[model samples]
Target: NSVSEYTKLQKEISSKRQSLYTLVESGSGNLTKTAIDKINAIRAEMSALEIKKDKAYKRLKIAKDAYADKIRSIKREELGQFDGRFVPELAIPAGTRYLANIILECKSYFGGPIEMNVWRGVAAYNCGLGRTKEWNGLPYIRETVLYTRDILYNLTRMLELKYAYSTGDSDLIAKTKRKMGV
Candidate 1:
């Protein structure tokens, strides 16, 4: 399935990124010409894999949308709102759209919401410490950890603000208040 392929490609990308980080941190001056050549090769391969991943994602999304449209058509017919040739556009709210993308990106690595939060926390901790540290008790590179932390933090903050405004949830509001030390 495309999902499994996407997951594999994501892992490959992560590995390649870590490898690239290691090479940069280790200093090219100490590396043999062959090692430098290998690094360039890895970089090129990573770029190609990224392009492949994007194509795979597009295919997956199209498949999902087709299935959803079919289900929606059936429901609309049952509700007496269907026309033979008309399909409604998929109109997701901006906040929900942003959150969905974040979930997808995280799920490629971390799976569900709770696991995603744990991953975020680990990244933040590593970033703040200014060194590579254990994530889920496994070593991760510092640069990637910091990048992941920023993405998670910004996405989480955006979702929290959106949900707090729309739902007026006391827990969300209180969490924000505590963050601001109110």
Candidate 2:
């Protein structure tokens, strides 16, 4: 597939670019006339290769985009189970706090009442309503409010972590870690 081929070509292009840079730096010295000519020849070849690679990459992107659109259309038509308003069930394999945080992050983009399948909302409501008054003597009882906030924050970071990994964003990863106190 052109998608996979493009990925390979991109790697080749990156390597070639680095090689050209190294060759230029090495040729910066005041060497003999013959050495300078050879360096110039190499630069010219690299320049041509760069132009060729760029064209190939543009074509590759167009091809990949077309393929993805086709796939999405097919999926949308086949999955007629929902009115396109179904929220996928998310499990908090990690914890309720982490799940709540992720839900908060998702709500920012979708912008509405984010209905979580988890019982974190109920737990938070109970804590706020003093339903857990009988357990006041417990050490964690005083931290009920703080724990709820942490749950919301951790869930947000977890969602952002997936996005950062897909886009290769180190800055996003760092920001998410800082927010979650990771």
Candidate 3:
């Protein structure tokens, strides 16, 4: 049985308190010694089980946290060195479009003949500001697009992390399982 089962059993055993009291009243020293020994043994076993449980939980949490931190650091490094170059002219600030050209530029790059979202996300991340709010108001045409793409890409990655952790994404869960050799 598991720890919980053992715990319940301990409780049930202890519920014989009335009998123990009567035994004590009758001066039964042998029964008292046996009861005390059994209780101590159960407690020791429970303590060991709890310690093992704590260690396992800590190990899993540390492994997952380290993985997440590494991914974020990679994104930050890419965003720090981005340079926007392939942005479309319509996506430029001078264009008549109501919506900022950067968003369109990002869409173009995303849906364009070349399906390189990761590379574009990396470029966007590297060329643009780390913060997404910096992309507002069509700051630098190319720069904004780069930042926008990078932010979107990172958001997707974040969602993937949540999905994997919650077991909401089977593929991600499978990948994690493979990584952990589970």
RMSD in order of candidates: 10.9, 20.8, 26.6
Q: Report the Cα lDDT for residue 180, model 2.
A: 62
Quote the positional error of residue 2 for candidate 2 in Å: 2.9
Better of 2 and 3 by lDDT: 2
Please give the distance, in angstroms, between residue 53's alpha carbon in candidate 2 and its true position after superposition: 1.2
The whole-model C-alpha lDDT of candidate 1 against the native structure comes to: 0.63
Stretches of candidate 1 above 4 Å error?
74-182
C-alpha lDDT (0 to 100) for residue 105 of candidate 1: 47
Report the Cα lDDT for candidate 3.
Answer: 0.49
Candidate 3 per-residue lDDT, tens place, 32-105, comes to 67767765665666566556655655665676566546544665336434332212332344432422343455
Error of 2 at 163 (Å): 20
Native-to-model Cα distance after best TM-score fit, residue 55 in candidate 2, in Å: 1.7
Worst 10 residues of 1 by lDDT: 129-138
Better of 1 and 3 by lDDT: 1
TM-score of each: 0.46, 0.35, 0.23
List model 1 lDDT by residue over 74-100, tens digit each.
Answer: 754463354322343433354345445
- Quote the lDDT for 20 in model 1: 86
* Candidate order, lDDT descending: 1, 2, 3
